[model samples]
Target: MEIIARRIATEFPKTNQAVGVNIVSLVNALAGQVRIGLLIFLGVVTIVLLIACTNVANLMLARYAARQKEMALRTALGAGRLRLMQQLLAESTLVALAGGAIGLLLASWGTQVLVALLAKNFQIPRIENTHADGWVLGFTLALSLATGIIFGVVPALAAASPDLNQSLREASRTAIAGPGGWRLRNTLVVAETALALVLLAGAGLLLKGLLVMRTTAPGFGTENVLTVDFSLPRRLATLPGTPSMNTAIVMTDRVRFFDALLDRARSVPGVRSAALVADLPLGGGQDSLGFQILGRQPPPPR
Candidate 1:
């Protein structure tokens, strides 16, 4: 491809030194910044998930601390350490699954709201078709189970091996937790706070960027403007004195068709004007066509 580009550039001898070709993946060319933005949002979502998990872990720790006497009593009554851990993990898994169900429901409703909101502002492809399908359900289920086990492990381990004598001797329900338990809880709270701050900072930056974009003008009047997109048929039927393979004739027909379409649009009631363009302003994507400068000889035909 580079060699071909160099050969093509040589045809424009005066501009050969200035001309260069860059190869970009089609996905990158089409999705561009939108893809980057989605990735950033995904990272933010992951951070938020971590914050939520940290908070839940702290709560689980507190719950286990409160139940230290029960755990010790169970252990004294022939309950193995594995049994106690399993019980705690079961409770955590149940909580996580419940939360996941609720989140899934909210996400379903929220997706509709988001699609409607973004449709008016941005031109994201196939956004309207967004839905929680089988893959989404599978992912949610996996995430719920993983989150339950991962976040539950620390508190479960801390609670499963309680001091049998001290916990049983302490008659008060408000007995202080062990240093290990306190340390773990404090660590979780600190982590939760830090993650929250990071999320806030990221959100603030994104909001500021969005506000700046909204305020910035795109060198065109946008009010009262409407855009319609259409495509011409790729294959035309062969007719008398007309070659279906002629590219120039096909483009001419397409141009005339657009002109007529615009004329009809202008004639409609309450219509002030209409015009045609290859791409709309602030459309987030563009199509490029080949053209030569005036007074320059055209390149040889392939």
Candidate 2:
């Protein structure tokens, strides 16, 4: 990006103006004005994934606690701690893979719904072309494996080192989780709660902002207003083997076209007025023309 910016600056230097360039991913470029909002949503999704992993870790801890005696018996017989941890991690990986599969399916459907809802509101180029492919599948597989290994570690470690004497006692149905186990579980719960609360707070703020915007006035009556946008072709239409019209004639034709269009629109019933503007009010873009005052030096750029 820096290289591109430097090249643009060197090639397109302007007096009192900086010429720069920004490099973005195709997805970010397509998102355009809503790119920041999309990034915030991506962060929220990451937090949700972390909370899910924490919850899964807590569940694994509980499961291990229930089967403490079984693990102790296996250890007493001949099972190695490394072997036990491997078995637990394998189980967690399988579970994660299954969940990831389900999530992928739902995500495909959700993408279609999201594109349909937002297409009219935003200028997202080629949004409909978005779909799950090999890359998405590969990412899902990698993420699932990583999540499984990370969340499964503490529970697997705790379960692999059970108190043999306590677990072997006939009266003890469930093995007691030591301070470390308690701390790990508590910490996961706390982290999960914190993430959830943060998500809720962000959602509340977004909803409140929307409500405020809904109530706010735009200082103009928007009713019965119909705006249309179009572009003029660079070259005027010409018969085959005929020369194209010059710039002056082309500009004259464009003016006449607009005059005819406005005249036709005004002729329609219930049409109170018609006017032309370079850009619509409250449009997402602005058009500007630079000018200098006569007999006055232009101010320096800030």
Candidate 3:
């Protein structure tokens, strides 16, 4: 980028301007405008994932409690503790893997839809070709396994070491959860709720920022606005088969064309106004040129 900037600087006829060269990372250049919003979204999604894992763990605990009698009976029938735990863990993993499969399907479609929407909103050059690929598949598989282990461990431990005597004795007395289980579940719920509230607060702040941006003045009137694109003919623009047009010649022609077009445009009934600009504001960027004050030291690069 710095080299390109220097090359463009050399193209200028004026020697009065001071030019500087700089380079920026492509990813940073592309994502800079929405970096904050993207970060907020990522944080919120991470919190949501944590909340989900906690909720799922709580559900697994509930399932373990409900099957207390069955687990105790299995223990009585000479089931190994390791075997019992493995069976419970396997069930939890199975559920997670199924969910992961469904999520992969959703992501495959969502990537295309998201890219299309981004292309419609922004002028990003390569926005519509994203898809769930190998890295995404690997991430999904790893996340599913990790989620299963995180949420299933406690329940598996509880099921594996069921107090054969205590569980069997109290199995018929009530269907309610034990005090310890309730305590654990309550802790997880509290944590989930706290994280959820944090996510909500982040979302609210992001929305507020967007609203402020929308309301802020953009330094130009947009009401009842009409815009059009203009281009010169092949000969005027200097095609390879045609003689090259000098800069002065091209500008003179371009100005004449716009003047004629503007007159015609204004003549149209109900047309308010017509104008032209080399580049639009809040558009990508204007071409840059070097400049120096006539009687001062060169200013540093911005």
- Estimate, for each residue in 1-302, the C-alpha lDDT of model 2 and write its tens digit: 67777776666566323755557888666666677877898999999999999999999998888888999999999999999999999999999999999999999899889888877666677776778889999999999999999999888999999888888884454474678778888998999999999999999999999999888898898889888776665454442344555666776787798899899989999999998888666775567668999999999763
| Poorly placed runs, candidate 2 (over 4 Å) | 1-32, 170-173, 223-278, 289-302
Q: Of the candidates numbered 1 and 3, which has the greater lDDT value?
A: 1
Residue 86 lDDT (model 2) = 98
By summed lDDT, the worst window of 10 consecutive residues in model 3 runs over 171-180
* Candidate 3 accuracy as lDDT: 0.79
TM-scores of the models, in the given order? 0.74, 0.73, 0.75
Please report, in order, the local distance difference test score of every candidate based on alpha carbons: 0.84, 0.84, 0.79
TM-score result, candidate 3: 0.75
For residues 36-87, what per-residue lDDT tens digits would candidate 1 score against the true structure? 9899989999999999999999888887878889998999999999998999
Model 3 agreement with the true structure over 1-302: per-residue lDDT tens digits: 66666676677525423566656788877777677667767777789889888899888888788888888889899999899988999899988888899999988888788888887676654566567889989999999998998889887886677777778878553232667666777888899899989988877987899999999999988788876765777656664333555777777776798799889999999998887777777776658766888899986543
Error of 3 at 298 (Å): 17
Best candidate, TM-score-wise? 3
